[model samples]
Target chain A: MNDRTTVSPSARTTIRRLPELANHDRAMLYSIVDEAYVCHIAFAANQDTHCIPTAHWRKDDYLYIHGSNGSRLIKALSAGAQASVAVTLLDGLVLAKSAFSHSMNYRSTVVYGQFEVVQDSAEKLAALDVFMDKIAAGRNHEARPGNSKEINATSVLRISLAEAAVKVSDSLPSDKDEDLDLAVWTGILPLKTTRGMPIHAESGEHIAVPDYVKNWAD
Target chain B: MNDRTTVSPSARTTIRRLPELANHDRAMLYSIVDEAYVCHIAFAANQDTHCIPTAHWRKDDYLYIHGSNGSRLIKALSAGAQASVAVTLLDGLVLAKSAFSHSMNYRSTVVYGQFEVVQDSAEKLAALDVFMDKIAAGRNHEARPGNSKEINATSVLRISLAEAAVKVSDSLPSDKDEDLDLAVWTGILPLKTTRGMPIHAESGEHIAVPDYVKNWAD
Candidate 1:
């Protein structure tokens, strides 16, 4: 399933301007989305558009994003609006030989699709599990599951990754031959997302941080 | 000019859901934009909408984003379409007491405005400087500036931060009293963006790494 053929890009998903940087591999797109902790979802709020940053998790071909049931964007999505989701993982800073060529090395996926509100209680409950387990393995069992009351108050929208585009620039800075002779330093300063020592909450003082939290470095 | 009064949120920019976490402080918004290395910009492409991850920098009242002249999103913005720019700084993970409350600590800024294409050569050059200097101080001068040809090949869009909103969730996970007694560990796992050692490019073998690069911990 993780093949370029599975991710057939339409006119919207096609990377036309800089086609060289576009990757058609489905696995690459999945990896970028999976590794990212947040996604910026753009949905039409009346005539105007609003892009919101929210936590997201992926299950198979669908990307699940949850928010308060009262959110304007969530309401719009739940009402069946085409949403554009962008997840970008910044890998490093590319110091090019020239200022114009300077850029960032990032793996970004843009998925354009209509969101389907997961209404079934069973599916919604399972979707909540995907959120926790995706972030940290075994977190679903460790934490108390969401009760029906709490689950009903939250809204989950699922966007299929079937129509998505992945753009990545993971290489070293490419410099012009003329600029190579310049005395300026050219290279990449890799950026990494790291987890610091977990801080126990006021109510969590007695419980020990599980192995999942300790080894949770995404 | 960096006052909440300047960043007056309009109806479209207001946060109706979870309004308590919304911040109107302009400085907080500026700091979030300044600290972020990349931003996701959404623009319309005929019947389709595209959200792209691109490098962005902020000046006093304007947020500047540049892209290839041939890019569809850049062209759309230049053609006076309303652009939605979202900059998100993920700070940590909030492991709530229950799955329903699982959230992320992030400072996100969403700006809604019609981008004005920067036409002046002098202003475009200065904007490029802001891109590098904002990310790494003093590196703009060290590298060669964009020549007229390069400048002409790039399309720069400036969006005012006037109609903008900043949403932040920085608090620890809040769980219900009933769930607190569960054996699960609940707390915050802080996420930090750190820079690793600078890697020299093929042409930068002999040049000493500059102080600006060494001290460049964003």
Candidate 2:
């Protein structure tokens, strides 16, 4: 059963040093998760831990991550091992007055839960649709439909966002009083992820760029 | 002692499912590690796993990660729990004819090791300088120097890139013959992280943007 408990900062998720930056608002959690296309899924296997980066998407309350049925991590997760998923969007470089104070402005979310494999064919299809649309609008309909073999060969794991933690560090760089007069430039060098000009595939060169793909931006 | 063993596909670092895409070349590993600014660190703490995103920089064969001395993860690492650090750079989106064939073009590296605290003040200061230049060139010399207290307050964990896994996926989308003729746009929507115009702090607005920060790019 999916846990629907309200997310409270447990000893695990609490931001100890900078407690003010911890956020538990549901909207903020959803926004941070929605703004990214990739996540790192970490799990313990063979007496060691590994974090695998993969594509991810969010629906109402569940975060869906799909991978090949043969993936070891997928098999391990399906066996009920708890997984930790993290998504991070680096916003900018915070340049402070002192080297010790330099930091990055970023928004990140960490979700910890046991993933249940989506076995129902219909649910799997719907999850696939959500994944495609999350990556690009109108992509599922535009692309060839998923066949039964394809659906069966894929493993879709669903995790509830009930025990999630969201942390945001967007404050301007602060300096010590004594360092303020130092002859250094102090400001933010904002970093942005932008969509560049599309490059057509070998056979797709003659195909016109679809408006959905052309106008897509993060 | 830092582990200098050759990077092999051990049980933890092996790319089992997609073995063809695995890369272990030292130069390729260094290149992938050098190109990114942020990494997601995953570790098991308090019976739950957490993957926190933080800025990272590589020097020679060691990867340095610093955080507040009171951070739970840092404390756990110092106490001798191994960490799994993953850095992913999204190069483009692969739009394919079939949903199952769609994938992202990216370069990522995963390093697994226990971190040792850099207790020597000189080594710690030099590591901090390397970090500053990695983020923004000339940032360290331009900024106010770190005092002894500040140096003591920070925890810099050094992990040798001994057992690491690097994966680069730059392939164009390939689909089944029947699905290739589908009327879908098949191409790459390249994603790039670029620097935006600098925004100065309140008192630093009058200072000219330095050439080092101005030319910084990832």
Candidate 3:
């Protein structure tokens, strides 16, 4: 049997159960990770645990998680040498008249794997390039390269998509007949989270928006 | 020790971990559920697994989950009679030079509990009201009530916050002695997710904009 997991809550909205919901395949993996700007990563560290939501970009079957050497997520994975990463995207809200009838539609993923630090000089350079391209599409070559000082302090953790799942729920509310006439209003109030136009960093003085930056997805 | 359940992909972002990471205390539970608008629920049914994301709201001690009578979540929980739920909020992105050194700052919670259909008619009504006020901040009284027909078609499930854990991480990248001077753009691209303006939902045309609606929270 597949080692299936469950996400239960005091509310049913948090517990999604669609058959088409769990996407463990490769194609679905890339699509889910590429569309969003932010992802909430849940990882196990020490005897304790933590979930860190941060900016991320995917390259093939590997997801790159970054942090200062001081950050908990990085420290946990680097020290314990094993981790679980999860990312979710919220699309919109689904409303139903009965208080118990409201819900939302969204896309989410959770990955389990042992992360390995990138150390090879050329491989490290490639990993950095992929990260830039994944986040900004083509910004890697267009933007200035990181100086030696900046590269030394940064750390990147790579989680191979060895075991994972993609789950999505997209349906309007289904209210009942008797409760229909109750005074509460019901309908979807959709929510979309996206990045705004590139606001050149203050340090980007005089540098025109690179074509790579302009071409990045929303 | 609290019961430890596995959170699989079938339920979306729901994950299972040790007791330390899966706490269900008062202060720990309220903040995680309160601060989030959506959640990832994991469950199992027909001997398979799944997880999905949906909107949610909370009551005093119990959380209210609404869905179509045919929802996969309700179907599974009502069957196996239990599940897991998780919500995570992404705060920012930490970009570092090395691919493995990147990370993020965020807060998240995982709750494991048995799911029961809210059978009490009176309590279901109250739960719906709380949901309305929670979202629109007083729109419940202003909006029209639901007819009986609406309530009958939807299913509401209730689960206790008997077990859960909350984790939050925030930190910046380190400009190591060598990588610090790489000239590449370095630093965090801060991120925040919040509710936007009141759409003055078409149904609310008669109500006009109430002060509560005008001053909503993030």
Candidate 4:
């Protein structure tokens, strides 16, 4: 973890709507990015704006994503196109007495910057290992490591997390004073992403379940 | 539901990477949009691209979103700016014997279009009702409806779902023949968004829990 405690929002990263929900603490940004399995990235290509979802991982103060060398997203970002990435985790639904006051509880972060291509082979391999570790701890060492040919076919890119904005809404329902006395049911309906029992592949059923898989649902 | 069976993919909506994983079925597109609580919208404004997450809902052939009239997203899209919207649902992590073969099972859809503002007051109100129903079936009737002033402050915009692409990845792990004998525990680790117990607001604890809240987790 870095010693930085806060992020300096860029012109585009500043939150204008409901600024009270904006958070600047660097740890909050890291946690939001770390907990999410995928992030939606927006970039312009061929004079068109595109939003695409892909797996993401964090290493130090940078967010990393990998894709085939010929992919449109990789080609566009590697060319130094300005991009915005968003990761949102819906925590719950806040039902207020007033329809206009209804809201959602969520933790979301948006990062703005140009992606830099990871050109060094060693750095690229280490980054991929970090991504694999994110998927399943200790499995990276056990799985067949990527061969030169496989690694060569992929392109890894990283963007700094300095210019980012975090917004978290975890409060209970807040209705207008006049609507508070209404007889409608007001509450929070919590939502969480949970893991289910692991299913072993047909060829690997004889292998023992790893600690990561065993503790996944817990 | 409309009788439309498929979406005609435009040049921008065509899935070039992993084309076989793409589905043109209109029902698949609707199901993906209907099941998602939020979508990431990508649009270019002020010479920079932005990807932001916002609550969304579908009614008939259009996906709708509402925001404060002054919000950046609402303003940018209402100006006829081209946009791309993506909704992604991650189902599981696919672990394979080889690190390079690791994949994710997901249902994702991307729509490319320009959002048009809902000008009619009655139409906007009815669209918001559909959104409320998605949050809770009968809560719209019980909650204090939005007054004229509140309704006027909100901007509702809808984008046609005709130019959309659906991609569903539900296959098992597939590793190379040479790596099949590897001893790694390969399988699927499922992930699902689940509802937790309802939490009543302090002022409304006396009210009975609605059936939607009661059956949320089930």
Candidate 2's residue-wise lDDT over A1-218, tens digit each? 22343457755566676778887777778887888889998888777777778888998888898988888778888998878899888889899888888888888888887999999999889888988887787777678787888888899999988778788889788898988877778888888888888777755465667787768655
Compute the lDDT for candidate 1.
0.83
In candidate 4, which residue ranges exceed 4 Å CA deviation?
A: A1-3, A203-205, B1-3, B203-206
- Candidate 1 per-residue C-alpha lDDT over B1-218 given as tens digits, one digit per residue, 9 for 90 to 100: 23544466787777776789889888888898898888888777687766778888899888998988988878888898878899999889888877777778888889988999999988888888888887678888788888889888998889999888889899889888878777778778889998887777854356768896777665
lDDT of 3: 0.58
Compared with the real two-chain complex, what DockQ does model 3 have? Answer: 0.10
Alpha-carbon lDDT, every model: 0.83, 0.82, 0.58, 0.92
Clash tally, candidates in order: 0, 0, 90, 0
lDDT of 2 at A173: 89
| Fnat of model 1, as a fraction | 0.75
Report the lDDT of model 1 for residue B84: 89
Error of 4 at A57 (Å): 0.2
Q: What is the DockQ of each candidate?
A: 0.71, 0.69, 0.10, 0.85
Best-matching candidate per TM-score: 4
Model 2 pairs in collision? none
Docking class of 3: incorrect
Which candidate leads in lDDT? 4
List the candidate numbers ranked by TM-score, top first. 4, 1, 2, 3
When 3 and 4 are scored with TM-score, the better candidate is 4
Candidate 1: where is the Cα deviation over 4 Å?
Answer: A1-6, A203-206, B1-6, B203-206
